[model samples]
Target: MEQAFSGRRVLVVDDNADAAELVGEVMSLHGHDVVVAHGGKAALAAAATFLPDVVFLDIGMPDMDGYEVACALRRDPSFDTARIVALTAWGDLASRARAVACGFDGHLVKPAMLDSLINEAALAR
Candidate 1:
């Protein structure tokens, strides 16, 4: 999984600064170019420059939910092939349904296991 993700561009968005930094650190260790965005607005700004191949977005952000972020990214032609994965605390049936409806390519239940996100994205690639 690490080898597959290495050299790839990734974006990690979370309202919690610590969580985002932790994810960024983990991805960086595996040689992925990672950008950490603290909110949906910052995520969009980063996307403009970073053009990430994969995005891990937190669903419970106070400013902008992951669903909204995914919707916005999907509307952009540039992100048509980007893997937008929702990171949520909940992993119930309803949550999965909502994620599917929101244009996310995958879903990671939080404390998001990097393995799941990476493996799913790699397979898609």
Candidate 2:
């Protein structure tokens, strides 16, 4: 049987307010502690204090893209064990490859299924 996890610290980052809030709300409803960051900079700030167990990041922000944020987070020792998943509309092969190259643990396309989000969070270490 598969193991289960709950109450994880989850960070949802997206320049789109609705998207971020929606994901945050979903995670919260599923019993995870959720923080929504509207941009990459805010994401970094929130991560510093939130120290999330799992981060769902959007790739196309204007200020800083998810790839950059993922790189920055990967450099921080505190995030060494955190799961960073690219949550974006860019589902093309190249984008997925780029996400992997930038230290993302997983890649979920935009409008990802609710069950997928919960399952991903549960996989966080």
Candidate 3:
């Protein structure tokens, strides 16, 4: 797809490097500056420095789940303007509701379609 997010910054957090990189590449293709973090702690650390416009956070991780990370990010004033999107394999309504409760701005099921994902990213912008 053609780039639509030139100059934008996006953070991607996933334990699976391949999945994270795939999303990162897609964001990069859209001209966004993509930062990939392998876990919740790393993701938060990167957020402090990257100050991304949007964050794609995975629900499952070693140190912390996406819920904790989302709560933390929501509490941080630095990330107040950043859009937090839950990215997980769990696609059920319950999981999505949990993501919302945790302060995620949006929820994306794993293996998301490129168009829908890109659309959500654009909506965040």
Runs in model 3 with CA error above 4 Å?
1-4
For all candidates in order, the CA lDDT equals 0.83, 0.93, 0.87
TM-score pick, better of 1 and 2: 2
Best by TM-score: 2
Per-residue error at 79 for model 2, in Å?
0.1
- Models ranked on lDDT: 2, 3, 1
**Residue pair clashes in candidate 3:** none
lDDT of 2 at 63: 97
- CA shift of 12, model 3, Å: 0.4
TM per candidate: 0.90, 0.95, 0.92
lDDT of 1 by residue, 77-121 (tens): 999889888877878899889888988878788876777765754
Clashing pairs in 1: none
Query: Please, what are the lDDT tens digits per residue for candidate 3 over residues 33-103?
Result: 89999999999899999999889999989898999999999899988788888889988988888888988
Q: Per-residue CA lDDT of candidate 2, range 9-106, in tens?
A: 99999999999999999888888889999999999999999999999999999999999999999999999999999999999999999999999999
Which scores better on TM-score, 2 or 3? 2
For model 1, state the Cα shift of residue 115 in Å: 2.4
